[model samples]
Target: MTDNRVYLFDTTLRDGQQTRGVDFTPADKIAIARALDEIGIDYVEGGWPGANPTDDRFFSEPPALKRAKLVAFGMTRRPGRSAENDPGLAGVLGSKAGAACLVGKTWDFHVDVALEIDRDENVQMIRDSMKLAAKRGFEPMFDCEHFFDGYKANPDYALSCVKAAYESGARWVVLCDTNGGALPHEVSEIVAEVVKVVPGDHVGIHTHNDTENAVANTLAAVRAGARQVQGTINGLGERCGNANIVTLTAILGLKMGYETGVGDKGMKQLKKLSRMLDDRLNRAPNPHAAFVGDAAFAHKGGLHVSAVQKDPKTYEHIDPELVGNQRYILVSDQAGRSNILARFTEIGVEIDPKHPKIQRLVEDVKEKEFLGYSYDTAEASFELLARRTVENVPDYFSIERFRVMDERRFNARGQMVIESEATATVEVAGQRLHEVAVGNGPVNALDLAIRKALSTAYPSIDGVKLMDYKVRILPPPPNSDGTDAVTRVMIESAGPDGTMWRTVGVSANIIDASIMALSDSLTYCLLKSGTEAKVDA
Candidate 1:
C-alpha cells in the first residue's frame, strides 16, 4: 500500500499579508507563526526577509517552531544578476529559516514580456538559486509562478523550469496557478504531466481562488500525485484569495484519508485555528465555511433535526466533533421537540425528552426570538434561559439598580477628555453591596462596577474578560417610532482557560440591554467554573 503522505505548507504570514486589508506587524507574525507550528503545519512561510520593515523584523528573530520548518519566501535571482549578488535571493538566503521558497517565472510570456529576458536565462536563474540555497544549508523549494498557464501555452519550457530546480537540489518544485483561472481538470492533467519529470513527492500545488476553484484545483493536483500543498489560513491572499488550508486540512484528514503532519489531536483544533485567525484580524468568521464553520453542522429545519437525532449521518457527511465543531440544533418558531432535546444534550442539561415543561421552554424561546433576541449566535444566553425555566438556577448575584454618568472635562494637563462613571447596587450571598467605578466608556464603567461588587464574593470573575460586544437595533413594535425601537446586545467573554461563550440581551434602552448581557456573561462564567453560591437564610 502507498504511504499517501502529504506535506502542508502555510503562507498566511507571507501570501496572506497581500490581502487588501491585512498587514501583519512583527508581533502578529510571531503569534501567527507559533500558532501554525502548534497546529502541526509542515512549513511556516514567514515572509520576504528584506521586502519591508515588518518582514525584516520577523526574520530577524523568527518564532521558534517546534515541528514545522520555518520557510523564508523571496524571488529567484533577477535577470543578468549573479545568484550570489541578487539582493532578492540574498534576502531569503540571509534569513534564519530552515527552508526557502523562491518564486520564479516559468511562463515564456512572462519571461519575454514581463522580465524581458531570454527563456534560457530565466531557467538558469531558477537552477542557480536552488543550488545556492542547498549549498547554504537550506532546504530549497521553487515556486513556478504561472506554471499552469505556462504549461498550457508552452509545456516544454514550463517543464524545463521545474526540472532545472529539481536537478539543482530543490527539495520541492511548486506549480502555481498564478492566474487562478484553470479548472480542476486542467490542474489534474498538468500536475500529472509534471510528476512524470519530477517525482510526486517533490511536487507541490499553490492556487488562487479567482474562479472559486482554488480548493478544487488543489485537490485535483493532489489526486494527480502532488505531495505538498501550499495555502493560507482562511484563504487570505491577494485578489479573491488562496486555497483555504483550514478546509483542506479537514478534507484531507476526514474525507480523503491522507496522512498529514496534523494528527488527530491537531485535527480537533481545526475550528479553533480557523477562528483564531479571524479573531486576530478583528474580522467576523464565515459561518458557512466548509467543515469548521459555525453553520457547517447547524440543523435548522424540524425534519432535519428529527432525522439527525436518530442518526447524525442522516444529514451530516462527517461527525462535526471530528473538527472540533459541535452539532447546533437551532430552535425558533420552526423548532420541534427534537431541537429542544438536542440543545439540552449539547449544553449538558439533563432533562427528560417528555418533560411537561419542555414545551413551555420552546414557547419561551420563540417569544424571545420574536422580541429581537437571537439565540443562534448567543447560545450561552439560550442555555441560561433553558436552565432557569426547568432547573433550580441559583441567583448568584442580583443587580437591584444601576446608573451611569458620562461627562466631558479638561484634565490637569488641560487636555479635553471624556469620562464615565457607574454605580451598582447589588445583593450577593447574604449582604447588600454598593459599588462605583470609573472607566473609559459607559459600558466599561458598568462592567467595572459589577466586578467591584462581585470581586470579594467571586474572585474568579477577574480571570474573565469581555472579548467582543455587538449591538443591533430591531424594528419598532407596531406603530412605535424608530427612536423607541428595541436594541439587542451580544457580549462574547473568554475565561481563564480560554473557553469563550456568548450571551445576549434585548431592551428598548441600550444600557439596559448591555447590562443584561454583561450580567449573563458573568453568571455563565461562574456556572462553568463550578463556583458554589452562598445564600444566607
Candidate 2:
C-alpha cells in the first residue's frame, strides 16, 4: 500500500462507449464500472449526462460505487447561452457524480475548422466552462483538446487556452494528443515544457494509439512528470483504438515499479481479461500479449527448457507464477527429452529420461503436431493422450452412427426443411444405454445424441451448453475440392457456474472434428467436476 497514489481514470464508459460499434447499455456500463472499481481504479468516467438517455440514466441511477469516484464528463456551455440554461453544461451539474470533467477546444485550427469560431471565442468558451464548474462546486478537469498538435501549430493559442482554464479555476488540465500520432520523445519534452508554463498538480495524459505508441508515450509522460494516465479497457476507443490498459498496467507496474490493480492477480488477469473481453465481443484473443499471453511463458527450444528447468531466470524476466501464469514446456518437432519431462513434471507426472513410454509419447506428440495438431490450443487432446497410459476413463457416451438430411423438399413435408438424426451409446456401472436424437446440423445432432445417451449417468450435464465454435480448414497439399482438407474445430462450453474453456479437435472429416472437439469438452467438464477423466479417443 504505497501512499504514492496515481489516480486511475477510465473513459471506457464515456469515450470508450463512443467507439464505433460500441453501445454499452446502462446495465453493461454498471457491470464494467463495478469490475474496474473492484480492481482498484480511482475513477470511472460514466458518460456525458445530456448526450444520451442511457448515460443520463447512469448518472441518475444508484449503482454500486465501491472504490471508484464517479465522474460525469462533458463539454462547456454554449457561446450564446447562460451556463445554467445550456442543457449540456447543466447536465454536468445534474448528474450523479460529485465531480465533472469539461473539455474545450484548445487548437486554433479546431476553432476555425471544427467549431468555426475564432481563438478568442474558443478561449472564452473554456473560461466560461471552468468558471461555471467552479461556481457549481464541482472538481473540474479541463481536457485541452488536441493540445499537442495545437501547440505545434500555434503554441501561443494553445498556451492561451491553458491560461483561460486556469484563470477560470480549472482543477486539472489534461493534454490530449487526440489524434494519437505523437511519439514518446515528443510527448515527454512537450509535457516537461507544459509543466514549466502551467500549474502541474493534476496534469494528465489522455492518448490514443493511431501510431501504436499510446502506451509508450504514456510511460514516457509518467517519467517526464505527468501525474495521471488515461486509457480504456482492452483499449476500445475511436479510430485505431485507444491505449490498452492491459499493456499500460503491465509496463507501468512491471517495468516502472508502479502500483496498479493487485500484482499477483494483475499479472494473471492480463491474459484472462483480454480473453474475457474478446469472448464477450466474439473475437479471438491475441496469443502474443505480454506477461500473461499464451506465448508469454511458452518454451520451444530444447536448450531453453533445460536451462529454465535449472533456473527459469536464464530466459524469463520474472517468475510467471507471480501473475498466475504457468511455464509451458512444449512438445513439438523442436522438443528434446528434457522438454517432455519438464512438461510432465509440471502436471505431477514424472518420467525416466530414457523410459520407453517417454520416447513413444514424445514421438507421437511430435508426429501429430507436424500434422497440424497443436496441443497448446488443444488442451483436451493432450489430456486424452496423457490419460491413454494413465488409467481407465469412463465413457459417458459414445457415438455409433449419425446421419443428416437437407433438401429443398422432403417426402414428409409440404415445404422444405433440413433434418438430422444421430445415434449414440453409453455404459454406466455395467448398464448400457442406446439413444437416438435429431438436430439442425451434424454438430447439433451429436450434441443431442450425447446428451440423451449420457443423461442417466451424468444427470448434472443438462446445464451444459455450447457457447461458440470456430472452424478452420487445412487442406492437404494435393487436395482437390477439399477432399483431403482437415477441418479444425474449437468449441467453447459454459455451464451453471459461468466457467468457460475452449477445446480443440482436428480431422479430415467434419463429423470427426465435431465429435473430437465435443469429446474434449465433456472430458474437461468431467475433470473439472473432480471426476478423473481418461480419454480413449
Candidate 3:
C-alpha cells in the first residue's frame, strides 16, 4: 500500500468565524470542536489565541479531544521582532493546543504592499516561527496565504517561504487560495510542481469558494498528490466560504477510494455533522448542498420515483444511508402510490401498500400542502397527520381558547417598555385548566401559559424547550391585502433526552399560526414522552 490517506484539517472555528454575522462564543467553539473530533477529523484549528476574548477564552479551557489535535492559528513573527521574543508567537506557543499554524505572506505583491518588508525577511519570519514552535514541543504547520496567487506572480519567492517552514521542522505546509479565484486546472498544475520540492505527504490544500470551485480545486490538488485537505464543515468561511469538508470526506471515501481519518463509521455521520454546524449557528441548512442536503437524494419526479422504485441506482448517485441521510419520495401533484409507500417506509411506518387509507393520506397531504403547509420541513407534523389518517392518535390535550395582549407604557424611570401577556384555557387529563403568563413577546407568553396550564397533568413538559422558530409569509389569496397573507410558522423543540422535532402550522394570522405550531410541538413532546414511558414500563 502506498498510503493514500488524506488528513482532514477543519478551520471552522478560526477562518469560519470571519464570516459576516458569525461570532462563535467559547462554548460554541468547544462544542463544534468536539463534534469534529467525534467525526474523526485530524486537526481542529481552534482559533487565533489572544486575538479576541472568545478565542482567548476557548484556548484557555479547550475541550479534551480524543483523536483530533487542537491547533492554534496566528500570523508569523513581525518584521522587527525575533521569533523567541515576539508576543504573537508567544501567544500561539503558550496556548494549550498541541499544534500551531503560523500564516505568513506568500505573495510578493502583499510583501511589497501589505507588510512593506523585504522578501528575504518574510521568508526568515516563516523559518523562525516554525523553529520556535518546534522548540516549544508544538507540531508546527505553515499556512502559505495567497500561495496560488503568489506562485503565479513570483514562483521562486513563494517556494522559498514554504521551503523555509518545511526545512525548519514544520510538519505540514498548506497552500491557500486566499482569494478563492484559482481554477481547478491551475490548482492541479501548481500543486504538482510544489510536490517536487516538498514531499506530497507534507503538503496540504486550502481553498475558498469565491469561484464556486473550491471543492473541485481541492480534489484536483489531492489528485496531484497533496495529502492534507483543509476546509470547514458545510463550507463555512469568509468570502463566499471554504470547501465543504463534509462533501470532500464523502467524495474521498466513496468516489476516489482514498482513506481518511473518518472511516466508514464516521462517514455515516456526515449529514448529522453538517446539520449540527448549522444548528449551532442558528441558521437554516442549505437544502441543495451536496451529499448531505435534504434534497440530495430526494426523488420528486413521477418518472424518477418510478425508476427509483425498481432500483435506487437509477436516480441516486450513492446510498443516502451511507451518509446518515435517507431517501425522500416527496409527495406532490406528481406523486404516485409508490411515493406514498416509500415515504411510509422512510418515516418508519408499516402499512399495507394496498391500504385504501394510503390514498386518503396522500390526498390529505396534497390538500394541506396546497393550503401552504409544508410537510417536508415539518416531518413531525406530517407524521402526526399520517398516523391520524391510518390509525387513531391520542389527543393528549385540546385548547379551548387563547388570548394575548401587548401593552407599551412608561415605566417608573420614565423609560418606555413593552410587555406581553397571554391567557389560555386547555383541557388535559379530563380537567379544564386556565392559566396566564407574561413574557418578552406574545409567542413566548403563550408558550409559558400553555406550559403552566399543563404543569399538574404533565410534569415532563417542563423538560421540553423551544430550540428555534421560523416564520414565512406566503402570498395571499386573490383580493386579500398583503398584511392578511397566509403565514407559516415552524417550531423546533428539543426534549430532555436530546431528541428534537419540528412541527408547522399555517393561518392568515401570524399569532394563530404560531399557536397552531406550538400546540403541535407540545403534542409531539407528550407523544414521545408517553411512548418512552411505555417502553420503560
Candidate 4:
C-alpha cells in the first residue's frame, strides 16, 4: 500500500540536453527516455519534435515507454496561423505524442517583445494550440510562459490566459517560469489564486533555477496543491537550469511523504542514474548535489562518524536507501579508528577493535595525511591500508631494483629508458612458482619484468592489466607551512578475469605514491578474486 502520491515529470532530453556543450542524438534520447520510464516518471518530455530532427527520430524509434507517458514540447501556434496548419502543432501530431505541451507568451512584456504579438493574439495562439492538440487526440499541457510575472502586472489578463488553456481542452495547465526569476512567495501566492479557479488536478509547476530557488519554489508550489512537478536531473539546462528531479523527488518522497517512486529500486537507482548521466555527458558529477551526490551520504570527521555509528540520523536526514544511495564513511586525517572500522566492515572486512595492528594503520594514515595525503576522496586507497594493517601475510611481491632515465638532453634526441624488475613467489598446495617481470615505469617496469620473467615458469598466472591512475598533492592546513607535500595516488586496474578495484598509495615521493597505488590495486583485485573463488567452491 502506498500513501504519498505526487506526479514526476522529467524533461531531461527536452530541456536537460539543452545544457551547454551537451547534445544527445536520437539514440541517446531514446536511451534516456526508456530510463525515465524505468524510473517511473509520470511524463517524459522527449523534446520539441518539430524543432529537431533528433527528436523527430526519437518518436519513430518505437520507444519502450514502460511507465511514463511521452510528451512533446514546443511553442504555441503562430498568432495568425491556423493551429492545425501550424508546423509546431503538426510536429506534435506527427511525433505521436500521447501528450503535447505548448508554451505561449503570458507576460505582457513577452507578448510585446519576445513573441512579437499583441496581447489578444498571444491568447488566441494559446487557445488554438491546446484545442488543436486535444482535438487531434493528445493530452494537452498549456504552458503559460512567465505567467507569474504576468499575474502581477495584469491579474485579469493573466487569468484570462489560463482560462484559454482550460477552455482549449488542456489536461494540465503548467505555469512556466521561463526566465526562472520568480520568488517562492510570489509563486505560492500566484499558484494559490490560480488553483482556486484552475482545478487543482489539472495544474503543474514548471520552474527553473535562475534565482537558485527552484528547489524552494517547487516545495512551495507542492505545498500549495500543485500535483505535478516538472524538472530535470542534476538541474541541468541552458543558463541556470530547471529544478532537479533528484532533489524534487527526494524531497517529495522523504520530506513531504509523497509517492514519487513505486518500489525499493528508488535509492539505488538514484545514485546510479546520477552517475550514468554523468558518464554519458562526460561531466564530473557535482559532489554536493543533494540526494544522489557522491557526498550526499559520504561521512568524514571523527565526530560525524562517531554519531553516525550510534544513530545515522544524527548526521543523515533520510535513509540513503530511500534514494538508491549508501553511506560511505571515509577515513582521513580527521578520522578515528571508528571510521576505518566502519568502512572496512561495510565492505565485509572487519578489524578487531583492540587489535595491535590498528596502531600501525593509524600512524601510517596520520603520517601520510600530515605530509599531504588525504584518504577522504580516496577510499579505494584507504581500504588497501586497512587490509595491509590487519593481514599478517599479505602476498605482496616487493620490488627489487628499478631505474628511470629520461635521456631528454638538449644535445641530442631524447631517449626514454625505464627498466624495473620485481619478484613474486607463491606457494600453492605443495608447489612453488617464482616469477619475475620487467616494464617501463620504475613500478610498471618492475611489475612487467617480474610477470614477464615469471609467466614462463608459472602456467597458473595468465591475465593482468592496469586501468586507471590519479594523483593529488594533499593540501596544507590554514596555518601550516607549505614547503613539503606528499602525493596521494589512486589507481584502478583490472585483470583478465574481469575483476576491478581501486587502490590508494601515499608517499613523499610522487613516483612511490603511484607505485603504491598500482601495487595495492593489483593485490586488492587478486585478493578479492581468491576470496570469492574459495567461497564459491
Query: Better model by lDDT, 3 or 4?
Result: 3
| TM-score of every prediction relative to native | 0.90, 0.89, 0.88, 0.85
Instruction: For each candidate in the order shown, give its overall lDDT on alpha carbons.
Output: 0.92, 0.76, 0.90, 0.76
Tens digits of per-residue lDDT for model 4, 455-494: 4433334465666567778765677688555677777666
The C-alpha RMSD of each candidate to the native structure, in angstroms, is 2.9, 3.6, 3.7, 5.1
Give the 10-residue window scoring lowest on summed lDDT in candidate 1: 528-537
Q: Write the per-residue lDDT of candidate 3 for residues 1-537, one digit (tens) a residue.
A: 255989999999999999999999888999999999998999999999989999999999999999999999998999999998899889999999999999999999999999999989999999999999999999999999999999999999999998999999999999999999999999999999999999999999999999999999999999999999999999999979999999999999999999899988899999999999898998989999888998999887768888999999999989999999888787765667787777778767899988999988878878888889987768788778887888777777788999999999999999999999999998877778899999989999999999998766778989999989899999977787777679999998999998888899999888899999998888888776664222110
Please write out the lDDT profile of model 2 over residues 385-502, one tens digit for every residue: 7656554455545555555544344556576677677766654434566767778776887788888766656667788889888888886746456576688888888877997766
Instruction: Identify the runs in model 2 with alpha carbons over 4 angstroms from their true place.
Output: 1-5, 259-284, 321-329, 390-397, 407-419, 425-433, 477-482, 495-499, 527-537
Q: Which candidate number has the best TM-score?
A: 1
Error of 1 at 399 (Å): 2.8
Better structure of 2 and 3 per lDDT = 3
The RMSD (Cα, Å) of candidate 1 is 2.9
* Best-to-worst TM-score order: 1, 2, 3, 4
- Predicted structure with the largest lDDT when compared to the true one: 1
How does candidate 3 score on lDDT?
A: 0.90
Q: Residue 229 of model 4: what lDDT?
A: 88
Task: Give the Cα error of residue 76 in candidate 1, in Å.
Answer: 1.6
Clashes (candidate 2): 1
